[model samples]
Target: MSSTPSASLFKPLQEGDPGDVGGYRLAAVLGTGGMGKVYLSYTPGGRPIALKVIRPEFSEDPEFRRRFKQEVQAAQRVQGLYTAPVIDFDTDGAQPWLATAYVPGPSLAHAVAQHGGLPLRSVLLLTVGVAEALTVIHGAGIVHRDLKPANVLLASDGPRVIDFGIARAADTTALTGTGVSVGTPAFMAPEQASAGTVTPATDVFALGQIAAFAAIGSPAYGEGSSHAVLYRIVHEDPDLSRLPTELLPMVTRCLSREPADRPSLTEIIGLCHELSPTALHQGEDWLPQTVADSITERLRLPGPARTPQPMPTVAPTPTEVSPSTPPPGTVDPYAPTGLATPSAPGAPGPVRPRAPEPPAPGHHTATPGYPANHTPPPVTHQPSAPQVRQKSRRTGLIVAASVVGTLVVLGVIGSLLSDGGGKEENKGAGAPATSSGPTGGDGGAGAGQQRKDPKPVSYQGIDLTDGYQLMLADNPPRPVQSEDAAYDGGDLYFKVVNFLDESSIGTDNGKLVLLDNARKGSLETCRTETRYTEKIDLDQLTQGSQICVLSDAGHVAVATYRGRSSESDPGSYVTLDLQIWRNAQETDGN
Candidate 1:
C-alpha cells in the first residue's frame, strides 16, 4: 500500500517568494479548483508554464493522490501536439505540484461570451480543430469524460483540447458501480450520465452538442436546472431548428439518443474537414452567442486582463412573401424553395397580379361568372341601327356554333380534358387542334399537351398554413402518394409543417429532403421516398391545394412555388416551400 503523505514538509525552496520551483519561477495565479491552485510560471529561459499545487485535504487521500500521479503519467503519454506537455512533477513533496507547458489563450467558453455568437464559417473552424484534438486524445486510449467549453482552449496555433485530469484510460479496471454520474452535467452524454460505458460515440455526441452551441448560440437542449438539462439530454429531442440549413442534418445525426446512432470521431473530423480548412485553426469562428457571452462574462470575472469588448448584434432580414405568378419575360417565378427565411416581420407583401390562366382544365372561366351582354360603349354614338343589328347577328352565330361543337366533342374526351380544350379555342374563335401522341404511361392526356415551359402551379391560398407555390413542366401526372412511384415533370407535391413536426413524419427512422432549385436533376427525374404518421397530416385527397406525396413507410414531400413583385421592379422569383421525409414517426413522441 502507498504511504499516507505529509502536508507541511512541502516548504518554499526560496525564502522571499519561493519565486522558482524546479528552476521555474511562479508568475501569477491562473485559477483554483477542488484539487489545487494553478499558477502561471516561467523557466530561466523565459518559457511559460502552468504549475498546479495540490490542496492539503486532497493530499491526505492516498488513493486520490495515487490517481493524481497516474493522471500525470497518463497525460505524459498523450503525444498529440494540441495537448499541453507535462514537463515535470514532484509527488513526494508535502504539497505536490506539477508543471505543464503554459498554453496561453482563452477558453472556448470565454470566446463565445465576448462574441455574440460564432458565424457559420468560424463554427466550421472550431469544429475541425476540436474534432482533430478529440481524435488525438482518444487515440492515446483516454476517454475525456469531461469535454465541455471550459476544457477547450483557443490558442494562437489552433484549438487545443486540455484538462485530462479526470480522463479515464480505456482497458483499465472499473472500480465504481455503473450509472455513477461524473463530469459537467451540461456536456455529458446520456450514457455518461447513467455511468454507462464510454466510447468514441460519447465524444461524438459531446462534439455534436458543442457544434450546436456554436451554431445557435445555445445548447440544443435549452437552459434549465442541472437535473432538467441532464434529463432532457437523456430523453428529449434536440431542437436543431436554429442550426444553419447546410449543417442541421449532420448535427441532428450526432445528437441521436442511441449511442450507435452517433457518428465516430473520424467521421466527425471528416465532416469538419468538409466544412472548412480554416476551421482546423485555433480560433473557432463559429462561436455561439451563449458561448461567446459565457466566455466574455468569465473573462470579466476578476482576471488580470481587462474585460474584452462585446460583439455587435445584427438583425436578419425577413423572408419575402411569395406572389402568384412571375412577371413577364422571366423563365419561372418561384425558383428558390426551401431557403432559410429571415426573421423580419412587416415585410412588404408581393404585389404582382396573377398570371392569365393557361388553356387547361380547371382554368377559372370568365363566362361562368360574367354576362356577355355587358358591352363597351362606342367612342362615338352611332346613329345607324343596321350596324348594331349586324354585330348582334354575328355574335349569335359564333355563340351557337361553339355550343354545338363542345357538345359533340364532350362524349369523345373526359370532362377534365374538355374543360381545358374549351379554353384553348372559345366560341368559334377557331377549332383547338387536339394532338395525338404517346404519353409517358400516365393515364391523363394533359401529359403530352404541355407547353415547352409550362406555367407555374398555384396553391389554393390556404392562409396561415405553411403552403407554397410550385413549378413543374406539364409533361405527365406525377405520382403524389404511393409506396414506390416515380415523379414526373409536371406534378407538384406539397405539405405544411413546423420545424419539429417536419423533423418527425414517420417512425423516428426517417429522413427529410426539401427540394428546391438547389437540386440538380430535372423535377421529373427526382425520385425519393418518405414516411408518414397520423399527426403528420399527409392527406392525399386534397386537390392542387396542398398536394402531399406520401409513402407507406411514412415518408412525405411537398412542393410549392412563390414569387415577388414591386411597383419599381417586376421583383424576384423563387420556390417558397418543398419538403420530403422518410419514415420518422417515432420521433414525434419525444
Candidate 2:
C-alpha cells in the first residue's frame, strides 16, 4: 500500500517517480484506493494528468481486467463540461493504468472534514456540479456505481466526479453477481441491496447521502456499521427534517428507494438552481422546466396544490399646473425681435410688447413696453412710385434666381432616384427567375449559385421523428420538404443559426445551441437561450462528412458521419431523419 497524505494536502506531480505510465510520468501519490493508487503525473510535453495503477492482485484477475476495459469504454462515452475527462489508458500493459485529465481540488470528504461540513451556498454548488456530471454520464448510457463524498472533488471552478472503476454500462448486460452489492455499501440505495439493478436513480440516492452530509455533517442513514446502515437505508425513512426547506424536495427526491420514483439528473439540475446559491449565480435555475412535464408525464405523481398570489400594479401620477399661464410658445433668438398687435378699426390702436419674459409657475407678466389690456396708436403713411417700383424690381430678380437654383437641385435628385430605383427593380427581377430556373442549370447559374451561398430559407424547428435527428451527422442538410422526409428511429432536432459575421459556421466553425427561454405558464419557463459548442475533430471533418444535432430542449445531441463532399465547395449536409416516440417528444412548443 502507498503512504497516505494529509486530507487537506494538494500538490503538483514531479518527475522521475515512476518515470512513466500511460504516457504520464509519476510525480506524487495523490490518493490510494482499495484496489488501485492515483498519482499526479505529467505528459512528456509537460501536460498535467492523473495516472492510476491497478493493484497487483486485482490485475492478476482476467475478469477484473475485462471489466476495467469495459469501464474505460463506458467512460469514453461521457462528454460533459463538469466531468473530468479520461485522457489515455493502457489496460493491456503489465501494470494496467488509466490516465484522466488532472483536476485540481480537494475531495468532498476531505473538504468537508477539513473545513467542517459546508455552508448552504457550497452545498448548493456541489449539488449542481455533481448533478450536471450525472446528467452527462446518464446521457451517454452509463451508470456511476459509487457516488459518495469521497468520490466527489471540490475544485476552484466547481465540483467533479472521479472513480469510474465500478461504473456499469446501462443496457441489458448484467455485470455483477446476484444479491451482492458492487458499490460502496454506505452510499448504496435500498434496491441495490435487495435485488435492485443499477440505474441513474441509484446514483440519485447516493447524491442524497452526500448532500445530507454537506448540510448536517452526517449521512441521512446515520453513522453505523456498513450492514446496519444498509439495513436502515432499505427500511427506514430518510430523516430530511433537518435539511433546509429549499433543499428538502431535492434530498427527498434523491433518497427515494424506488428507482422510478426518483427525479432525473435534468430535473435535479433545475432543483439545484432553485435551492443552491451556486446554480442561481450560474443562472441555470430554469433547466428544470424542460423536463418537468416529462417527469410529471412519466411518473404521474400528484403533488400538493399551491395558491397563486395576485400581482401588484402601481400607477404613475401626473404633475399639476396652474391657470393664468401663457400658452406654450417658442422663442427663437434668430427671428425679428419685435412684437406688435393690430389696431382695432375705428376704436383702438396697436399694442407693442418688449422682449417676452419667462413665466412664473402659475402666472405670466407682460413685458416693460407692452400694454396688457389696451391698444397702441396707429400710423398711416404712403410711399412714392419710385420706391415701390424699385422694390418690385428687386423682388422679381430674387424670385428668378431662387427658381433657377431649385430646378438644378431637383433635376439632380430625380436622376439619382431613378438610378437607385432601376437598380432595385433589376435586383428584384433576378431572385424569382433564379429560384424558378430549371433544376438542370448545369450547376453553374442556379444550383451552383445556391451551393455557393446555401442561404438558409428558415429554421425548420428540430426534427425528432423516430430519433432520426439524433443520427444526423455534423453537416446535416436543411430538411427538404419534397425529398426523403422518411424518418428512422433515433432522430433529434437542434436550433442552429448563421451568425455568419460573428461565427465561422460557413468558413471556420459550426455552432450548436440549447435554449432556456424561462419559466412560463403552469410549468417552468426557460431562463435564457444559450449555445454550448466544442471544437470538431479536424480528421472527422476532412475524411468524412459530419453534422452536429441537439434535441429541442438541449438535453441530448449526437454526432454522425454524413459523407464526403463530391463538389468543390466544402459544404456538408446533416440530416435529421430518425423517428422518435413519447419521452423524446419535448419539442419547442411544449
Candidate 3:
C-alpha cells in the first residue's frame, strides 16, 4: 500500500481531471488517496457508478495490475445487503480503474457528522445490516481491510457496504510491500497494523470499530495521528466505555486483541437480530425521520413554472361574400357558414347583438369549481370592419370585369354565325348562356372550408420517488457511431422513455429525450427495438425544486433529491438524486 494521506472526500473533479476515465465519463472525484483517485462516473445506460482510478505510478507495476485483477475477480463473487458489488474494472489501463454500482445514500461518516450518533434502535438496525453485509463479504473469502464509517452507506432499505478499494481475499499475494500496513490506521485490526497474517477476523475487528463510531460518533480507540491510532489498536484495548452499556459486551468481543477470540459473523448477526427484531428491509424506514425528510426533499421534482406559449399567427385573408337571406351586407356579424358575399358599406344596418353563443354549451370561463367545459373558442381572424368593406369592393370589381368579358365572347360567336349564312340568331340562342358557373353573389371564397394548422403537443416533468436516480448526461444521448452533433438549443422539455424489453436497455441505453419546440421540431424516430440516448435538457428547473432522475431496467424516472440549491455554489450546480432501478413495476413508475 502507498503512504500518501487520504486528502479528500467525494468531490467535484479538479482541473486536469480526465473527462473520460476508461471510456466512462468521469463526473466527480469521489475521494483521493496516495495510490489513486476515486471518481464518480456512469455506465452507458446513464447508470451512475463509482470508479476507483489507480495512480499512474502504481499502474506501471505489472505485478500490481495482476493482483488487482485477481482481487476484482474475487470481489465479483460477493453479493449482499450493504456491500456495493463490483460491476466492471480495467486492471491494465494506463491508470487502472474499478467501477461499482453507485449507492444513492450518504456515507455513515457523513451521517454521524450531520445527525450525531444514531439512536439506539437505529444503531441496532445498522448492526444487523452491516453484519449481514459482512457475512456476504467474508463468505466470498475476502477481508475488507478498510471497514470504516466512511465505507458504510445508510440506504433507504438498510446500510450498504462500499469502497472496497482496499479489500483483499484471505489467501492471495499481498498487493502491498511485504511489511506494510494497508488500511485506515484508526479502524485497522491488530494484525493489519503489525503486518501480521490476517484472516476473516480482521474484518470483524473493523466492523466493531465501525459500529462503535456509529454509536458514539468517534472511533473505539479515540482520535489520534496515524501512528498513535495504530499503536493503540495493536497494543491497547478499545475504549468502548462510551458505547451503550447493553451493547458494550458484544462490541468488546468483536474488538478482541486475539483474532481467534472474536465472535463469528454468524454469532454477531444472531445478536443483532435478537437486539433489533424488526431488521431493515424493503419498504421500511431504515434512516431516522429527519434524515428521511432531508432525503425526500432532495429528491422532490419541482413542476416547471412556465407553460409553452402559443405560436404567433398572421390574420387570415378576408372573405368577399356570404350565403344569406338578408339584403347585401345584412348578414350576421360573421358571414353565413358556407358563403362569402360583399357586405353593405356605410354602417347604418343595425342588426341586434346576439347572446354570447352560450359559451359553446360546455365552455366555461376560468372560474374555479365550475363544471367541466371542454369546448374550445372559435377560430376568429376578426378582420376589421373597414378592411371587410375594402375586400368587398375589390370583389365587386372582379365580378363586373368577368361579366363584361363573358358578354363580349357571346357577341363574337353570334357575329361569326351570321357571316357564315347560318341562322345567326338561332346559333346565338341555341348556345347555353352559362357563365362558367360563378355562384350567385359569392366571391372567390365560398362555403368550401380551409384547413388550419394543428396545435403542438408538449410534455412535462414529474417528481421522482425512491428506488431511482437519474442524471442527464452532460452530453446529449445520440447514436454511438453517428458523428457528434451538438447544438445550443433553448429551454428543455422532458419525456420519459420506455425500453421495449429488459434486454433492450443497458449501460449505453435508456436515456431520456427532450424534444425542443415540439410544434416545429421533429420527435425522435429511433427503432422500437431499443433506444439508449436522446438529446435531453434539464435547464430552468423550477427555480426552487430539487430534481432527480431514475433509470430502471426498462423505465426512465426523475425525482427530487434535495429541497434547496447548494448554498456554496448556488446556480452553478445541481446534484441529481440517483439510484439503481430494478423490476417491471418501474415501467409503470410512481
Best by TM-score: 3
Query: TM-score, each model?
Result: 0.43, 0.45, 0.47
Ranking 2 against 3 by TM-score, winner: 3
TM-score sort, best first? 3, 2, 1
Q: Tens digits of per-residue lDDT for model 3 on 1-590?
A: 22221223334445477655555555456667645777765555555667777766566666665556545644655667678876666554466667777776767887888888887777877887788887776654456677888788777778888755354422243445543334567988898789755677888888888788888988889887888988998898888777987678789999998988999888987877676646544445767886665444322211111113322133334454332223343433432132112121111122222222222111112112211111123335454233224554778989999999999999888866655644443346565432212112212322232222122221121122111122232111111111122211211122223263111111223444322222221211211213234332334333323222223333233323233223221011222322222221123232
- Alpha carbon lDDT of each predicted model: 0.49, 0.49, 0.51
Error of 1 at 236 (Å): 1.1
> Root-mean-square deviation of each candidate, in angstroms?
30.1, 29.7, 25.3
What tens digits encode model 1's per-residue C-alpha lDDT throughout 452-509? 2222333221111112111222111111221222222212333334454331122122
Which residue runs of candidate 3 sit more than 4 Å off their true CA positions?
1-12, 165-182, 277-284, 293-590
In model 2, the worst 10-residue window by lDDT is: 344-353
Off by over 4 Å in 1: 1-23, 165-182, 277-590
Ranking by lDDT: 3, 2, 1
